[model samples]
Target chain A: MRIPVGTAVAAGSIVALAIVPPITEALREPFYLGLCLRLMILAIAAISLNLILGFGNMVSFGHAAYMGIGAYVVGIGAFHAVEDGIDWLANGFLHVPLAIAASSLAALVIGAISIRTRGVYFIMITLAFGQMLYFVGVGLEVYGADDGLSLYMRSDFGDVLDINDNTRFYYLVLALLLATLYGTKRLVASRFGLVIRGARSNERRLAAIGIPVYRYKLVAFTVAGAICGVAGVLLANRTDFVSPDMMHWTRSGDLIIMVVLGGMGTLFGPLYGAAVLVLVEEFLSGVTEHWQIVFGPLLVLVAVYARGGIAGALRALERRRG
Target chain B: MGEPILRLRGLTKRFGGLTATDSVTLDVVEGEVHAVIGPNGAGKTTLVGQISGEIRPDRGRILFAGQSITRGPVHARALLGIARSFQITSVFLDFTVAANVALAVQAHAGHSFRFWRDAASDDALIEPAAEYLGLVGLSDRTDDVAATLSHGERRQLEIAMALATAPRLLLLDEPTAGMGGDESARMIDLLRSFKGRFTILLVEHDMDAVFALADRITVLDSGRILVSGPPDDIRADPAVRQAYLGDGDT
Candidate 1:
């Protein structure tokens, strides 16, 4: 049997990402490693958003809030670790779990209210909640407020893993990205995922068939938030900085664009989306400072011409080849 | 012939000054097809909405299987063996026809929180789904996407989905609404095949299908039941004729 184009591309990209650190080291350019790391981290966030936006048909505009929450959890924990002499708070084990728990809690509360509305109202309510989190970040006076906080050190994973090393951290992020992709694949194909997809397609029909669509959607929303929180943790470690800007509504917009650009419901779409967007932005900004002017029309053309984004275009090509 | 499977007592509903259903009281007997017939704006859809738990009555109580379920949510009512098809075709258009029915089967199977196993390959869902599709004469289209199906085929798929729920009472709103003559005849035959095997509360505009398939008919005018009886009695009733059947305006 012929391998699907999407699967081939996804597998090829994974192999390529696995060797990025070695190639960058040989070239003596660590910046490329950092860029790839950033790409993978954002890809994780985009994948989480796809759970709701692409599969569940929830257009959440405030997803960046969870990433903000995750980063802040680490930042605050490190702050307490250094200032208050609470060293255990610096543990990666503690910070990662706490971030997941906190972000899921926030998602639960936001999803409960937002899932009641649909279409533009859902978008606005999610945006409102996201902005609420952004301002809360700004109001945090002890945690460096709007200026942001710097981590004295990366998350302490003990001897089990060394996230402080650039090469080691890249692998860690890569592993997590693969796990998210695998877990999501299992999730969307599972009974619970079918409920989510079915609800997206026709909520009323699901209700009439005895499925409580609201509860299922809220769970999917929370799951997506928790996964995004993990991405946030990695992001904080990668940059050694945490700020309210992490969860700004514009950042959330960036995540949405990544999902749309990759392919909304496709498994490997977000990764491709993140790569293209980060690489294109990097390339365009290098050519001209006003890169957004060029980028804006480029995205519109993709949206109008390619209905399903990059992954969709690939599938179309494969179909034509057959 | 059997005790009431569904009872609506003093089912009143209003939208501002317009009373959509004015104290509409009705009973659906077990193992019978009871069709609700009315002219435009006579509140047929609203009545179905209240029975299926989509719309809350301003003042009323709905009982199912001799239990009070007046304020229960839609899914709750569905779990209690109530299922409905919409006036407009409603299905998971992106899913395969089998998958659409599989979702209905999955609903009645158990809690859907199992997030590890692949649902599409589960024979437990797919088998029952296929059986129901066959029952609706849609077995051939089981793997086809629901969106690709024609209008009448979607109506059949809707019935298959409702049947998969193993519901005790089926609420069918306009099942033959947009069908051609041959399609309507086929639908009537399908409903006729299900006459005694299931209890159906049908809201429809096709008088011929209603007359042909209804074991009992309730005629509504101005949100109130003008007359109700077997087909012969409904045909003979002058008020129903003047208000609905015989009226040239209909």
Candidate 2:
């Protein structure tokens, strides 16, 4: 099947990104490619969160725990697998899959408890749970005790998929990110997606029409968490290390900022948001150290003036042009 | 043709110092209009809430379609064929009028998990939604955003959505709460046309509409039923006349 129109544009952008080796020798560095990979991972994570907060109307503030748990799955798996001298499964492919599953299961338990309440209470409970996980993660002296753990070798998915090769891993991130955007678009427009949109619009009305809203929301949250687990596994691979800092509250804020900056409730918002956020952190900081002082209020102004965020602004421009 | 579609036995609710609904016992027979009327703050809305499974009672049982549904959640109560419209208009304002009704129909037509198909373009959802909109006289405004519709029109759309679910019992709170005189008259005509087709529990402030359409009347005041009877009897009863008509206001 064909990819969507917006995704076709993104596909072209990736082709341009692939040709960076000719333009600047510095652009071809593994360091720069690694940075782009990091952005893609965060975008994947933010898009997952959007399904719950934007469409489901369930604002979960503590989504970083899935990332942390996903990170630790690799850390702990590699530690035990290496110590036992079992070279068969402790590698990247086996470890990352285990990490994804662990993250999703943890999300299920966390979502079940958090979905009972709504509004601000839901946000707080989820944040509390994420913080609790972060504390536990930090307490793990077994995985270097707050200092973090380094991977001795990147997980190898046998012969075809070598994460250590920057080009191969970059392509991998690009494919997954594009696929996530496609999957999310299909979901929001689908029948289940309509239920999600309805719940966000007026949950009571949805219930009065005989649709089980709570279960639907829980399922959305779990699915969002499962998708986020993929981002976490990739983040661990990109870093070649795992840390409790991945679950920190500020990191969660960064994720929210991406979703908000891109736009909430609109498709392709996360892509624009992720690209803007990562580019700002990389480029703006180069000009001055106090870049956030400028960036902070700008973001605030964007939120205050552009309630629909950048997408709304662009749409406004399009309307003016036409 | 069948058992009472909805039954309430001593449904009671208290709001701390205030009791909203006290010992409300109601039965809505299949295929009839059962209207609840009273002055402002008379607990009519609370009774509707209790019956529709939004608010649980302190003590009592609610039966729907001849089965105990007291323990069921709101959607469960709805799936058993009871639907409700709000006092304030509650459509998704940003969506088109057709989309709002289609969402209700979508909830009933099939599982909403079909991700690839455009929900709006699906004829299965659109055709029935258009029919309901036409039934409510909103077909011309089908593509219009709900927020742009006139107030009375939104109220009509509210009813249109409630009906889209194909409910056996419809609980309507202030169905014409903000409508003009003409809108109120039109709503009564709509109710009259809908009578005996499906059961309805209407809570309205309009005395004339109530008297015009109620097959049976239940008068509530201070969370207690002042009286319950035929419209003619309730109209003449001194207690209801004094409590609702404000001694001489009617």
Candidate 3:
């Protein structure tokens, strides 16, 4: 129990991923590689939102907008770079950093406006902003409108680091996800984390105790946006495509579902939730075209039966036993 | 007193037709226990709210430590060493007693930007938190979940947590509200022991505790000051006796 939950989770994931590549390659299974990579990216996205919703008590419904912002970054960058023969520094890396910056900037503005209201209003406003982003993504002609754009080639990390190859791409995505997980763990545990948690527990108490709750929550929101932006980039790279689907409200719901399914507020829970979701998607889809009919009911069950999600329920059980 | 540590001048708050706090003015010297006593509907809690920045006043200025802090928000006021406890025992019930106090310690230990280290493990945050807990007689129950504590004990924990901020002016809003006679007396004794170390602004209805511990008693009726003086002077004031305490009674 003394062991940091974040570190333990990161270690377990790395060890599991290390065994996956060789096993998949020997079995001549290329699709499983994509599935695993997709899970990692989604998990990373879910965890970013978890920092805000779970710990900060900020239920942002527009979280998928960051992911969309990130995808568009790569998509737009690749289009300009490929067509105009722009340099790597100009066309490729340009979009990734810009995406994160845009998302952070957007979060600052949206957070400012949304945090002015409390309870249900906050959730509604965030979802509204996310819908706006989704519509905007659909309207963009440069990125193929509703069709989505694909990268003809991956972002060059230099001559040695081609993202076009599946195995190399998988490792790179893994590294970034781990880094994000580590960063989030550090950010939450810091003095800042304590403040954020205090604000979440009781904003009035925090204010009386000498903390600017609104400011701390806004900063945490921006951090979550930036983190989600990173996840978006990995997601776009893994799929080799970008679409307005990335910013859809349902996508935001998916993120929330993953967070709640794994366990809201628990750092490792998001990863587990993401992994379980992708596996369920694969298994369900293999059975029939309308797997969602089955998946939707299962989610309802999870929500109804487990309000605290898996981790909270497990903790309750442990306490009962002890 | 030379520059009362906290001074409230002409503070008023109106709710539609209801005057929650009428033009109320009060003062607390650097090391005096100034008690405000009033009936249930006399705007006692409202006065505490206006003074603590929870409810902004429609009019009037507040000065803390010789400087006007009328425009300061709750957090800013708290940072300037003003700490207030709730009349209804408010605490971070989900957090452990130590974690609850540690948050107050974290607020004052510079910025909370230090990441990658466990905040609970940091001696800087923990030691001060522990010291305050010990002061409030909560040292043994530091690890206990605050929600599980008895109501009176939770009140003590609130004081300990508030003290962790190293407040210059401690505002206690009915610290003995829900306590039994013995618990209430013990709480009063604890507050009595805290005299001379920090300024206290106590708003309570308990006549025994108020009269016994107060350096100066301020009586409020209909959101206005009925009278304010030393216990002997306040006790004999006929107007106070009529407005608050009926006929020869306290």
Estimate TM-scores for all models. Answer: 0.98, 0.94, 0.94
Q: Model 3: DockQ against the native?
A: 0.75
Chain A, candidate 1, TM-score of: 0.99
Candidate DockQ scores, in order: 0.92, 0.73, 0.75
Tens digit per residue, CA lDDT, model 1, A55-111: 999999999999999998889988889889899999999999999999999999999
Please, what are the lDDT tens digits per residue for candidate 2 over residues A1-322?
7454444545665675565434434655666766677888888899998888877877778887888887777767667767776676556667667776787788888888899898889989999988998899899998987888887656667787887876788778888987898899889887788888888888888888878887788888888888887888788888989999999887887888888898887676766787788889888899998889878998999888998877667666656655
For TM-score, the strongest prediction is: 1
Q: B190 in model 2: Cα distance from truth in Å?
A: 1.8
Between prediction 1 and prediction 2, which has the larger lDDT? Answer: 1
Candidate 3 lDDT over A1-322, as tens digits, reads: 4544444555677789766777799999988988998998998899999999998888999999999898778777777778787757224356568878988988888899998888899999999999999999999987789998877756666665777788888887788777877887777777888888877788899989888788888888998898898788778778888899989999999999899898888867788789888999899899998999998888898889987776666666666655
Give the whole-model CA lDDT for all candidates, comma-separated.
0.94, 0.82, 0.85
Show the colliding residue pairs in model 3.
A191-B112, A192-B112
Which segments of model 1 are wrong by more than 4 Å? Answer: B248-250
Q: Candidate 3 i-RMS (Å)?
A: 1.3
Candidate 3: deviation at residue A265, Å? Answer: 0.7
Could you tell me the lDDT of residue B24 within candidate 2?
79
